[model samples]
Target: METSDKVIHAIYNDDDVLMAAVKTVKAKRFHIEEIYTPFPVHGLDKAMGLAPTRIAIAAFMYGCVGLTVATIMMNFIMIEDWPQNIGGKPSFSYLENMPAFVPIMFELTVFFAAHLMVITFYLRSRMWPFKKAENPDPRTTDDHFLMEIPVNHGNERELHDLLSKTGAVEINVVNNTH
Candidate 1:
């Protein structure tokens, strides 16, 4: 998103105001860039027309990768690199009866899936250590609801009127550039 574009936002005092604002915005066919609230609101994502996240897909892929790596590494280490007989057990074989390797494999799979999923989340969201968060209204973190509209074809006066009619207590035109 370019800094020069205009972003119109309305801050609602309560959830009733927020819910009404969302329905009105959707009814008007105006595109909402995003919304912020002190807490999750029911059906808010659906109102914004946002699709379900792909994090599950990412986690699954990472899990598969982890499992493959664990299996290959364990097989190589136990069967090929340093085969040894322990407790009169057979060497160079994945023991089906004992199942000693299953625990390690499971642990590695979980480790990789969790770590890689976190990394993927960080990268996808552009969230990094020491990076500034782009939260315009701090009140949204504490008892306020915010609705952001992409400034494309809508008139500022009309949008403001709509917000005010829907019980928005405060309306601000956020000039992203300056």
Candidate 2:
């Protein structure tokens, strides 16, 4: 992250060209700071050498917690706290009344997983409520694509040449404060 001092912002018109530029820069062992695309570019993570996400594991654990909560809550409400006998069916034991709790358990599990996963994604991406967005170029949100490569070891000239060769319509060397 110290390489954030100076960054070469390369703008490409097409996603295919941008992807090719990513591969070329990675092949040269140049570290890419980030890429801003109008849409999600498939295989970009692999091209950037990013590790596989652990969010799925977190979601699974959250789901388990939800399931456990539902089970314990239903058991307490139906059996331990107040044993209800409705239509000749007595909620005396949890296992005996498990079929009734299936809907609650399933709903809670899905609810926790979906909601918590979104929170985890936002937190991991450093996105917070009312925070100023860090978009360097507004065009990336529309039809253009922007790739940020931090200039390290004074490789600004080399990166500029490489980016120009990779079909970048615009390249700017900027002093990155953030």
Q: Judging by lDDT against the true structure, name the best candidate.
A: 2
Query: Once superposed on the true structure, which residue ranges of model 2 sit more than 4 Å away at CA?
Result: 1-4
Q: Which stretches of candidate 1 lie over 4 Å from their true place?
A: 1-4, 95-98, 152-154
RMSD to the native, candidate 2?
1.5
Best by TM-score: 2
How many backbone clashes does every candidate have? 0, 0
- lDDT by residue (1-178, candidate 2, tens digit) is 4645788899999999988999999999988888999999999999999999898899999999899989999899889998979777767699988887899999999998899999999998899999898999999899999999888887889999999999999999889866
**Local distance difference test scores for all models:** 0.81, 0.90
List TM-scores for all candidates, in order: 0.84, 0.93
lDDT for model 2, on a 0 to 1 scale? 0.90
> In model 2, what lDDT does residue 164 have?
95
Candidate 2 clashing pairs? none
